[model samples]
Target chain A: MSLYYVQKFIYNINRDTKLQTGFAANADMILANYDLTDEEACALREADIGLLYVMGVNGQLLMHYAAYRGLAWDDYIQAMKDGLAKYGEVRAGSYVTIDGGAGGAV
Target chain B: MSLVFAGLCSHAPGITARAERAPAELREPFFANFNIMRQQLEAAKPDALIVIAAEHFANFFMDNMPAYAMGAAPYYEGPIEDPDWLKIKRRKIPGNANLSFRLIKTIMQDIDLAYSEEWKCDHGIMVPLHFLTPNYDIDIIPVNINCQTAPFTPLKRAWAFGKALRKACDFVDERIAIVATGGISHWPATPNSGKINEAWDRDFLDKFARNDKTALLAYNDEAVYADAGQGGAEIRTFIALAGAVEGRKINIAFYAPIPIYAVGCTIAMVDLDES
Candidate 1:
């Protein structure tokens, strides 16, 4: 849904280590700052790499978050592939296509 | 003319963060070319290096993304990704604010260029610097193209920006080297993360080497997405380099489909002294 806020949160965290620390300390408090739906908020709290990819979070931003959550390089790539298989095609944002069909998804 | 060197190269974080995982046969030569480039760049003896990179969301976001932004700071720190994640330590890199101001002012004559005193170096930049300016000795002036978001700067504008940058470098007295860094055809950090289009990458590289402005500017987003993946949109950086060097063909020291690196890894340059 609120893909912009989802991407925005990670973008902010990616740039500001203080914000990253803040999110780690009190995720609920940080969640309140963004106008995010429950699913978006849950995804952030759970460090749900799959759902985040399904929502089309910019891969550049999302990958760092995956690292922050301790997913290794290969695991991170696999998380996205798994997300694609489970959630179907990315619903919005740049990676919306399935495979070469839209390939923004792959 | 102060523009002493110009070239394009790939900057996937995997080059360092996941180094040992890739086949040595491929990785070694790719790294060798980087060493070759660094030696060539040092031989030029530039006081400053202008990095034209396609920044991932390390600085500007969709809220206020500039089509193009340049660094006008005295110094900067980054590898903004975790130092461990990028395999590059976080440290201050030298910059030339005065040189940047002059180049920016000169560029503004023909382009509405945006600038920053506070710029962060993402993997798009850190990866190349790890190879090209390992000591972090030369001052840097980073220019970022908005290759990430939609409604991106048109390919023509990117070329024009390059032309303007060349003029700026020429107008200045300090020896300046420029390396435009970005992936050619890749799906970086995505479900199809390691996907690469060797054919598309080679074709584009051929057009770039020829400095075929018409052919270079002919690519559109849809085809790029289908064949090159979204990261492929970064040809703007290469096109900008082509624009910088004018019509001269670049000598590609290295080129290969390094899929684990998620790009047609390349190290190429044009020596201004010869041109």
Candidate 2:
């Protein structure tokens, strides 16, 4: 729904243990605190970076979220590529795939 | 007369510690270049280093992000977050507050450059310092530009700021080495975050290697931002270095795209003694 809230969730969860606990224990409980679209909430709950990309979450914010999820460097990048292939176009945000419809610039 | 060497580099926190985890083909060339840059710095042996890097809100948040700031403390402590994960030893990086204060006084009083003296560094400054100057023997002057934040300092202005730094260095007694850190396309935290723009990365290195500041300056804010995401704005750090060493020969010491780290990093040597 909003990249701001998506970023806020990741930023806060990374720094705050209470929020991390709440997110791990019950995503719904923590997600309720922010005004996010159902799609954003679901993406955050599932740790679905692909869907999050389509919804336009910024990469800087998304990277920390990926790290928080225990994704290795290669896996994090691969997931982004997969996200573009599966979702088609960066539905929103700064990295909305330039070079027309391609998932990446190449 | 005070300047010795100046260059640009990319700072990927985990690359040094966890490079073996990457594929050999990519990892080999990357480290080879990294070593070359390290050797070059040792050869230059400047008494002090002025690191210009993007602040990832580590020292300041969105609430009070300064466009440009200098850390003038006597002992600058660092690797502000996750030292273990970064493979960087958490320690207090030495600083030259005397030189730092001189530059600050010059820039603020003479050039009227906007600066904050209270800035503390994060990985942006430490990562490159870790690889380039592992000994931490030389004193450092940490400078930060608001690369990640909105309403950032423009590239042209960043270059101009470097010029002011050159003037500031001229007034100081210490022989200084200037290093600008960050960039070569790869979004940091988005879904397509790891996408490496090798084409763009190579083109930038080529221009800089040839000392083509005109071509480098050709890329305005919109062009760079559209091609490379916001974090990529760290290229301004290099632009500032170019301004400091306006007519120097540029050696593209290293160029490697570590997709695992999601950075198309490069290490360069700007020869101040050339002219």
Candidate 3:
């Protein structure tokens, strides 16, 4: 499977423990259900976390401050998915992953 | 074909022509740099200036995204703004529509791409335009590439396009100067804003100065992101410039990191030995 790496602040995971738990749990479930490597798993985790951050109520503020200027929500999501698929699972706790297509991580 | 100049620019604060409004310390240096470039441009005396820059959703967007857009017009108005970069007092420049159209035709025949006859110059083009021709009286031949959206032109492809551009310029039989404007590694926001990658910036500058096309062509989006902060789409401008001036030497004039906007503003000149 193709994988892409998603880089973000480590503080994100620590700051929102509930969201992190849910994303981690979702990532763990996806890994068991699908064929994935350590890298692929890590990438997914990163994507999940990044998505959560983007979907978070404060996501707009973060996006505005981030390098993603004038980016639409759909485009941003697509990029995240592409990153996850291209980089596979994110091995580093600092990264995340996605399926690179519609229907989310499943 | 020899390169006349190559450089990077940060597109924030808009392209203001008023030198006084620029960062106090940077104003003088900026003008000095422009003076040097202007001299080179005058020396070349190109009939038209072929500017390779990225469009910020000016013409293309989510629904329809053209890989590249070439302007074919007698004159192209830059973006509208309150303090317009091209003030009314400045004389409007005409475009070499005949030559621009021919160049686009040639490129399309050689490669599968699209062209546009109607489009306004966005900030990307306006920034350099303002600097190159403050009065906006010169003939402009503009090429807009989509660097924002994905499936972006690879470094290699952008370089190849530059080479093609040289051929296009040659076909027009006009002494031409090319300017590639964009970035040196800056993130224009918060949360992780005010970022500057000095190491990467220097490294990029060094490689660019050496005209290391291969090294540059090898960079993927991820690598660019890794080095040039998250907003590294501007790096593609360098690739395009390298392509246009295939084997020319680069002469760097100014490079200063602006922390306020998290970008490194630089100006460089590339001279091609036509001997």
Candidate 4:
């Protein structure tokens, strides 16, 4: 498994009910007030975080493009997993570990 | 042999002349920056320019993608955007097929890289082209980097590739300017839209101005991502420029954080004549 890091995570507390109330809530429930940096924000925006969970490019690049276009973190994660499930496993590299918070598969 | 000058061009609405329709405050800074860039281009007077920019999802997608791609044909067409707002018309470019083919061959030989010749001009390229050559008749060699995908080229590798590109250009017989277009920081979409990392952007600017390739290459993907933002992947283009110059001091022309688009709009011109 290749590891990817999420630079930041932003949630629309109101508009994205599923994300804010779901993944954001889960993250806050566990990590509580995780002060994300601009880098983390960028990673989250690029959806590099999903790179940790998926393999090959279809899963990784698609998630990244979604994030770049401003998809919510929770939604992006779910979308990635769904895409992977349909597309199949990404080609494996060296098993890697990303040093970031706990995140769910898309 | 050809002389090559290389640097970065941030492709924002402002730089593309679309900013005239924006607020005065926004338009003012953009125009000011444009005037400065114009002077730099005049100083370079390149017969042709090799632009390195990222393609939006339009060209490459999840199904199939090449890590790097080059334009080898004699002409390219710009997207049909606001024709009135567009400052330039689609025109033929002077393409050095021999130089382009050679560069591709050398890059492949030196590294495990994949590229394509069948791609069209996107905003990443057209925005700068509009400014650098309003008529779009001047010749340009276009190279597209796959910044959108993973297994991304490390900053150091990108720089090394730029050096290889310079060597390839030397094998030709024309004057060329290289422009790397992209960003400092931007969160393209979301309610948290106007996010601008000025602090991180300044740090990059400082490092670039100092011509610190060692420091730049040393930066891991995380550090750059942290400092530059998700769009920060574009920083590779700048590093490539640094490699082409090879220790020359960068003559930064303009830098502005356009918060509306969540992008750090910047432009830097380097003097390659010294080499």
Q: Which residue pairs show collisions in model 1?
A: A95-A104, A106-B192
**Residue B267 lDDT, candidate 3, scale 0-100:** 81
Select the stronger candidate by DockQ from 1 and 4: 1
Model 4's CAPRI class is incorrect
Q: What is the DockQ of candidate 1?
A: 0.46
User: What TM-score does model 3 achieve against the real structure?
Assistant: 0.67
How far off is residue A9 in model 3, in Å? 32
Compute each candidate's TM-score over C-alphas.
0.96, 0.78, 0.67, 0.66
lDDT of 2 by residue, B1-275 (tens): 48877788888664764666668887777767767877877787788898988866556555466788888877777665445555676687888777788888887763444454454555688878877888899888888887875677777788788889998888887788888898777766543445677888888878777757788788876777777665568888878888888877678877777765657867788766565
lDDT of 4 by residue, B1-275 (tens): 56555677787533443354445776577667666675676576777778887765435554466666777665655532222333445444456666666666766665554555544554567777766666665677778777766668778788887787777667666676788887766543222233567888888888888889877787776765555545667778888778877778887776766664346677787776665
- How would the candidate models be sorted by TM-score, starting from the highest? 1, 2, 3, 4
Better of 2 and 4 by DockQ: 2
Which ranges of candidate 4 are over 4 A from the true structure? A1-106, B13-18, B21-26, B80-96, B112-115
Worst 10 residues of 3 chain B by lDDT: B81-90
Best by DockQ: 1
Compute the lDDT of residue A103 as modeled in candidate 4.
20
> Which stretches in model 3 have alpha-carbon errors above 4 Å?
A1-106, B1-10, B14-23, B81-93, B189-193
Question: Which scores higher on lDDT, 2 or 3?
Answer: 2
Model 4 lDDT, residue A51, Cα: 42
Give the CA lDDT, 0 to 100, for residue A90 in model 1.
83
User: Pick by lDDT: which candidate is best?
Assistant: 1
